[model samples]
Target: MRARLPDIAPAGSPATAPRTFLRAALAIAVLLAACSGEPDPATTPARDPDASAEGQAGPIISIRSDPETSAVPAWRAPDVPVDAGNLAQRKQEAAAALEADELFGEADDAIPLYLALREHAPADADVATGLERALGAVLQHGDAALAAIDDDRAALRRAQEIAAVAREVAPEREAVVEYLARVERADAAQQANRSGERALNARKIVVAGGKGAVAHFREALRLRPGDARAMQGLAAAESALIRQAELAANQDDYAAAEDWLAKAAKVRPDMDTAADARERIARQRASRVGNLRDLGLAALTREDLDAARRHLATLLRIAPAGDPAAVELRRQIELASHYGLFRPGQAFTEALDRGGRGPEMVVIPHGAFRMGAADDEADARDSERPSRNIRFDRGLAVSRNEITVGEFRRFVTATGYEARATRRGHSTVYDERSGSLVRRSGVDWRSDYAGKPAGDQLPVVHVSAQDAAAYAEWLSEQTGHEYRLPSEAEFEYMLRAGSQSRFPWGDGAPPAGAGNFTGALDESPGGRHWRNAFKGYGDDAWGPARVGSYSANAYRLHDLAGNVSEWVADCWHDSYRRAPVDGQAWINPGCADKVVRGGSWASSPEQTRSAWRLGSDRDTTNARVGFRVVRQI
Candidate 1:
């Protein structure tokens, strides 16, 4: 019963088979279309061009597929005119989303959406207002970012971005542009400050009063108008320069001090320190002038003429050109040095002869002294009494020692003049065998008392007063100056020098080797009968030694006390009752005797006293007599 029901219809009925086949094909197509979610090609209608033109239905709108979401069927919809209500609803939805997400400023979100809505509905107040709000939000966000950035480049970038947005959104707005400009100025000011600080720290600002630093500081100020730090730095640099100038001045480096001071003046011409430093420098220079003047004057006083000249020259250089004291000091130095005799504590010669040597002279400065001897002086002769003040108004050149034999010989040779000893052909000499003075026919100025040959250095003796006068006159003629025998007063004045005692040394017994006196030859076999020997003193010589063999007196005059008696210009008088107070020779034409001062090698200690005086005939020649010349100044 289950198997045979449909068997008779199955084998050959054509109409029934065709109907079944058709039904199965139609159901397969419907199932495939539904599963694929695609409209049947037959049901898909063609776009209507007339409808699109009439705005009844626009061209079909094809929606693009989103790769991030599930795939949907790509369908085309007719672009129908949007409904006002629907568009309004869509705008409200987008505005609500923008508000909810607070994406009003976000360019990627609400800003683009608002822009699109504005394009569609250009007059929509809400869209315009929303777009404005979004733009403002963008500017605010950029500003916040810029403020948060520390790096200058980062800040600039942020500022530029804000400015760009503002230009695009509201081209007339200047807030962002102004902010960028301020940032630029601030950056420039900071850079200038840094550079200036570097230079200042390195001491490159050598000029005072901020001259070197001013340019940098000014630039910084221009960028950021009033900078206190820059002002302070400029002042400090100026102060440093002033201090350096002061230090140089303190060290007496006037040249360097002046240089630095000039720079300081350029820096701050009105600064108080600059004024003070200038004053101090002036005072220092003045003090130096005074110090130099003092040194030069002191040297002059000590007779150090060369040293005086050097110091005075330096003073003139440093002193003001017209300073009166400096001028006067220079004049004084010149006067002192005129004679070329400025050495102190030494003796020198002048007036060179053919032999290149002349009278050894001692410089005597103009001075006042008491001539002759004191009334109470022991052993002083009557002629030396009546002491009186005598002032030499001018400096004089006096011989340092008695004229020597060689010196006289040169004078005689040059003048070819006959001396009294050679003309007389005989002179008085000490006869050692007889121990008495005698006139010998062969003896002359060339022989000593003992008949020993006279050396060049021995004092020339046995010359008459006229012979000495002739010699002095010849010397004066040769040298073109007045050379003469010293007056009696001048002789005693020089012999005493500055001494007030009976003797030049002191009022004591003559010291051993004081001079060549009678005692000096006491032990000699031929000098026993000399009669006037100093009992306690001896010089170890029987006759005159070298002209300067003894110690010099204060005036550097040698052989003043002994060696030989010297002829003077005064006419012999019994006493000083009519003596002239002035240092002049008391001359009388009728006088037969000339005054002789000092003593001789044959004289006793009493006779060697500075004020002791004697007289001799004008033509007399003695073995114990010699003469020295004096030049009038």
Candidate 2:
């Protein structure tokens, strides 16, 4: 094979070299065919590897053997150093492209291109114009998107995206900032509206109406003014409250009905239901007034004064004060109370005594007391022994004051009756010369203890028991009432009042000016007979000063202690062994000595005790004796 290769060589070349050359030629042909499918490496533009790595697009390459016959794929150049003219031309082309497609929100496509162009051509007007136009297009598209979408969250997201682009592109655009704020407010308003709707649906019906719904609706209106749905919800809530009020009223729950009605009125005062409810309530109250009036009248007819008063008061509260029935009921109640039966502390004047011009009389309540005196009483007489318990079965009226000289004179003048003392022309009087009491002729009921003229206000002393009885009988006839002297028990009871002491005032010495007892007054010129006056006691009066010369007892009767001795209905008894337990007068058919009670100015302190008693001849008269009258009701 080596000898055959040497014969193929025409020159003096080696045969192995020819074979190597042919092998190299074959490799070149394979390489040329591989490159023929792609553009020629020498004719193709080179790409900067650093520019490509920096997020820049690959450079646009153009290779053409015939300019009109070949087409090149469109491409974006990698970001690179460029002249001002070329950068300007590129920015204008980009802006024109954005204008054509309106891909204004395509920041990644357009914004970076303009910024890269601006880096190369910092003062290029076309670059500046393109950048501004791109930002404007972005904001305008955002506004359009916000307007297109009905959802607030969607609009807000779109607006935020646009705002981000604008901030990077043109951060000083006032309209973009304003549009963002508007979107935020719109979002808040929409959120509030949703919350308000939920609250309105979730509200509970209560006595105070739908307060929750009202608050929510109001807030909704604040965020979104004049919201028709919120207004409608509020109206519905008010209507619901009014309906609740109506139901309560139908059930006769007037208080609850009123509460609901008030709530409705607060929401809408012009609701017709509230007005209608008020009218119905008025009718119901009017009917109740009628029922109450009937009850009051029935009670009055039954003589239940307290129950009648209660019902009538209720009626007045329900009915108007000017109602005729209420006025008449009040009048009836007053009339009944005025004519009621005798009770303790009740006071009235005799109608027959010149039409309520008679002496005032107080009703004494029926009670029991230990009559007479204790056995250890210092000055108690034998007639006051064996203190008995006497009870008054019925209340009686007694004169508030003793029979005055003026009152007795009226009885005498009307009846032309002569008193026993006047007929006798002699009475017991105080004789200053002898400093003792003595019988003085010409001294009668009209004379004082010293034989001086007595005033009409002073008590009519020197009256015998028979005279006192005669006067009481005359007054009874004049007044058409039963009047008589108090029983011995009644006399002592009235004198003691509620006291259990020696004196009504207390067991101590009588206070100065307590009553007209035998005191310093007797030391006066015409009062020398009171030499045994109680020590440390003075009333400034020798004898009776007036009918009420002393303070009254608890029963409000005056001069019951020491102004004068009083005549009682009982005949003189030695002891309480046979005393009447019913407080009636104890009298024997033939007993001529009547009982006298209470002490006079001429008596000592011991004699002035409540239980002290004395016996007096029925026809005998004395200056120190007087009487009070009692009447049966």
Candidate 3:
């Protein structure tokens, strides 16, 4: 019999129910069981015809719940309602909730429920097929479940083993179809949950969680269209790039810094950080050129003229004429002219020029003189002994006194070039009483002399050849004249002053009043001896005196031989034999040294001869070294 019980007891027994007008359901299994011993349809009950067919029929028993145990006791349809053709129709509705609740825990638990509800279900082909398919899927997994379990475990716990296997295997293979209805409910809930601010913040955090934050932000923007947080995070990343650039700048890694700054600028055109980065890039380029200037100076001073040319060339290429260092930059160019460093497209502007401050005009005239040392000269090295004749077609204009700080200020104000300051070199001092030179620090143009006026017309001592050239070029542009470094020939020509004598005065020792020299004062039986004026104070105290304190040369040039060593235009050739006879700077593509002539006030008398030669670094500007300019005739 098939029965519907809404309140059945748990697994041990069936439940009773109050059913005043209850619907009944009959299963096909129950019908088959009840008819197993009953009539054969084909024989048509022949014996029953003799006994009256209706009276011979068995009693119509209806199964219903027991009053006390609520078990399936008897189910019945009233006698007037016994219609065999409509039995299936009446059976369906009563079986539904009963079937739904009973099969809650098996591998194919719902299949039995569907079977009980089948007859009552609506007449729709789609629903029928769906129900059949559901039952079939459960059955398939049920078979797989049986196979996956060991025979021993299946026998011991068959029902539990089936459920465990179904949970593990069936979901993986057919999760989409099995959970189609459930997923719809879940998806709706997920959409609503994602709309809140907390969800938004969580998304932002996830997007920036790792090394790929920038890329993640981009992807997140695509997924959740119009996300403002992503856009702002991208902007922050750009700022981070700017900070990286700043770090590079601090380390002087300019190339890397520029690359980083460029990215920042591209990401945010209107950002102030980008603007600052661009400005810093410009400053870095300028600084790079200037530092090269210092290196060029050092190389020139070391007589490495080739290295000097290379450095100076790089400097000019990196910095345009409008740069702040341009004036001094032009001087480097002019000085480099003597080294063949300039190209055809370059512009030649005269650098800074100041007229001689003293009364003497010290005109180193236009003529050739013997430029190397004599055989018998004391302390003559091989590079100096083979002195030869050097010619000059034009003379040089020289200062009677050292050019002073006050004079250089005018050039700086007009041209905006930086004036370098460094420790003083041992060359600028003069001693009169002991006829000895005295050298001291704090004697360069940048440092203040302890007891001096620091006048503009006082010659600029401690000046390097390149420094002199820079000053000359700057002066030239300001005055509209072609002021340049005097050639070695011109410097000696002016120092000799029309005399063929071994010295400007004579072949004898230098006169005490004529120039500053190295000797003891008054021959006072070893009162005080003079060494280099740069060494320390003595009869001739240490450091430079005021410009033009001594008598002028015959050319009226003051302090030429004694006070400072002069810079010349020629690249140092070691000898004069192969030098230009036509009074031009000897420029070879390979030469890297420079020549200094007319020994300083710190040099000995024999060292001050017209033919005496001193070579110095082109880049060095010490306390006693300076220059004079000459215009092309």
Candidate 4:
């Protein structure tokens, strides 16, 4: 006799039916042991032939009540009946069904015909050979059907029918038991898939206590590892979680939205879907926070401080910590209450009441920096000794470039103010022909470095410190903002552009695009070059280029360290004695000389150092001196 194979129980089903076990034990003790009939042609007969009566009810789950046998499945009969006539006729009919390839199913199959004759003629050669052929054929069909079910779930029903016939023919056979197991697994996976769909439709994605679409999908994966249908259900569940995150973000509940995204990532760690969803949610959150920031800024602009505070508080709760927009809005609230509202690095032009705009200015954030060079610095001067820290608590705005000819022309034309050079009728200009700076009678604000009519775009070089202040005063009157030269400390800070290096660029040779410094390669109109200039460095011009001829520094202030040395508001001091630490201009009654900061086109490499400073007479005007304005905000 063939050793019996164990039965497969459904998940959560009892390992054995206790009540059925006791009843079966009593029946076995009362019944007499029967003799085996025509044994299987090639193997032992499957299940007791008498069990067919129980099979008439339907295909039932085999009970594993007896451990020794471990199997009992009396399957339902095939749908189509074969002839139950004389032995020869039955054999002929079974042969015909086999020829038709109807092995075991609803159609007229040979397995059913052989089964009908097996009871009475178990010893016959034809029945034995015919029965063995039918059993093997039916087992092959069940194998193919089970394999098909994995790819096409619709084939599951056919697989189940094949399993039923295999059970009726030989439930205890090893091949039959394996086929049944495959079908059951497919069935369990399908059920799991259905449960996931139902949970998803009910919006039970990622519920607490492991009971939702996530749970159901996980169960499906356990039932059939790597099943395509199970994987698809998981993807759907993950999508549901992502959608929830997106919705939460839209509602401005960013905390909850992040939680949803994290859960989605857990569900599908192998996929980029969760990562993409995270970015999408973050963008939505940014949009929502941005909206709040705009509302806060608008309210602040309208002078509604209370409303602006409320909006800012709401934005802070939703936006990530240290959000730039939220910080800007907060700055606006504070600045609007006292001074003008502006963001650092923000560029704008002041609108004059006279129906024109002032020079383009970039907002500067207030901070503290060391004002002078360290003691070990190369070529450090006594004027830059004893470096002191300077702090500007209030934000200010500085013109992006030196006031151009056209810009100063507007002030002069509007105010009819005569600059000191124009009044004197004599100002110093660079003599390119002689490679010298000479005082020319016609040199003034309208003159270029060579004492010619300057282009509107080029910086006006022949303006004195007094002239710049006069223009700043006129600008203040026109725009209703306090416009003046940057303080000595502020000018140094702007020139450094947040650097402590030897030069504004760095300690090394000026890289390409480091601005219009004195370069050995520089050629004047007369082919003149500096004897003590940076080798291999040239901007191809001997005179100052247009106001913004070079790239701006980190502060977006152009030409702060190149083109020309600009004047500051602070009076000239011999050294660092009693200097102002608050970034205010160190002025005294009747001061004659003012502080100048930055490198000029004729300056040597050491002179371009950020720490370099020059003190000039208040009435000084030259081809290499220009000025930009600063506005108090």
Clashes within 3 Å, all models in order:
1, 0, 53, 0
Question: lDDT (CA) for every model shown?
Answer: 0.63, 0.64, 0.48, 0.73
Q: Candidate 4 on 50-149: residue-level lDDT in tens?
A: 1211212211111112112222344565443334356677688778777666664433457767887776677778888987877777666555544554
Q: Of models 2 and 4, which has the larger TM-score?
A: 4
RMSD for each model, in Å, please?
A: 38.1, 35.7, 33.1, 16.8
lDDT of 1 at 216: 65
TM-score quality measure for candidate 1: 0.47
Model 1 C-alpha lDDT per residue in residues 225-306, reported as the tens digit of each score: 6554445445554554454455555544566667666765655455676677778878878887777766776787677878
Residue lDDT tens for model 2, 1-633: 111000122222322322111221110011111223322333433222111111212111111221111222222323544465676566655676555533332333455567677778778787778777766666665565445333222333444445555666555678767766655554455445444444433333222332454565556566556644445545654554554444454444556557776765665455575577667766876676767666765665567879878988777765665976676567556555433365455577775554335567887655668877777767777777888888766667888887888878777776788888789888888777887779999888888877787889888888999889998887787788899999998998888886777787888778866788887445667535455667777787776778776777767788788888889989987788867788899989988999989887777887899998888799878778899899997
Off by over 4 Å in 4: 1-152, 200-210, 243-255, 280-294, 319-332, 340-347, 350-357, 363-395, 400-483, 492-574, 580-582, 586-627
In candidate 1, the residue pairs with backbone N, CA or C atoms under 3 Å apart (3 or more residues apart, or in different chains) clash, namely 209-238
Model 1 regions more than 4 Å off: 1-348, 351-355, 525-532
Q: Model 2 off-target regions past 4 Å?
A: 1-340, 351-356, 520-522, 526-529
Please give the lDDT score for candidate 3: 0.48
